[model samples]
Target: MEGKRVMAITGVHHAQITIPRGAEEQGRQYYCHLLGLPEIEKPESLKGRGGFWLQVGDRQVHVGTEDGVERSSTKAHLAYHVTDIMAWRQRLQEHGFQILDGVPIPGYERFETRDPFGNRLEFIQPLA
Candidate 1:
């Protein structure tokens, strides 16, 4: 077994989203309180930065503050599924989130919203 490749299986341990300056608290509020994800405590080595890290089920979301990059396409947004799509939409609307009425994307109900730093995100639910 020494110096040989083994046939084992593993999956993605995490995913990350980088935001620009001053968006940490907003990201926390949205991902933690609003979306109900558990806030993963950052290691002491990664603290004192201008962003946050959050955990969603088995995945992780890392929000880092960039210096001067311009925000671009919303097409690369993250798509999340919820138990009640309409209710989620309403809740976001009630919180002043800019909701975009998206076209039917073949097999799912979808909508889009922008984060505090202008990063776009999507939410979709499959019709059952």
Candidate 2:
């Protein structure tokens, strides 16, 4: 409380999600090939642990490998802001990713869905 100053928080640098062990290729196919997020090389030290990183806009998403945990049935999730809410809904639905409607928020249109691994994801677009 004295002369100390509080540090201001900045934007997110990265977020992490997990997949079943030895399923990195599947993750890559869904996240990269289908979703269009570019794959970025993993750091040398973190390579042996499995999984890889992807570039989402200016931020990064790290997909890790783990097992036995319930990837679904959790509230923890990542929400990505997009330009077209309807198009994203259609595209993901075409691939059979079930669409879950998000709660109504004033001035926004959004929806939720799961990745192939069952990680909850939200896609939102601002309504002007």
Candidate 3:
């Protein structure tokens, strides 16, 4: 059994983040309008549940609703691979979003920002 094959998993299918109840519109605006992620329809069975889905290239980001005060974590976050890190930084700043510099990682340029609900998000571009 030294070389027995195990279950193979491909890339990520989706990443889910939660927002406070009644904040779905805010989530939609930030993800769809500002981030430019196209909104995807949720399945009929899940439509009764609040929140929506957005397309992220081949993957998806599922924004769900939670019943409680929203609190953001400083450490846990979603990092996305991008083509132009600086351009994204500028775009976010232009939209009145605060950009935070990420700790230096060799061969990678990245920065951090928050969504409307204060969820941490990171964008990274490989250094040439």
Best by TM-score: 2
Go through the candidates in order and give each one's C-alpha lDDT. 0.78, 0.93, 0.88
In model 1, state the lDDT of residue 44.
Answer: 94
Ranking the candidates on TM-score from highest down gives: 2, 3, 1
Task: Give the 10-residue window scoring lowest on summed lDDT in candidate 2.
Answer: 1-10
* Model 1 poorest 10 in a row by lDDT: 69-78
Compute the lDDT of residue 19 as modeled in candidate 3.
89
List the candidate 2 regions with Cα displacement exceeding 4 Å.
1-6
User: Residue 122 error for model 3, in Å?
Assistant: 0.1
Q: To one decimal, what is the Cα RMSD in angstroms of model 1 from the true structure?
A: 2.6
lDDT, ranked from best to worst? 2, 3, 1
**7-126, model 3: which lDDT tens digit per residue?**
888778999988887888988888898888899999999988999998998999999988664446557788989987888999999999999999989999999998878889999999
Off by over 4 Å in 3: 1-6
- Candidate whose lDDT is highest: 2
TM-scores of the models, in the order given:
0.80, 0.92, 0.88
TM-score of 3: 0.88
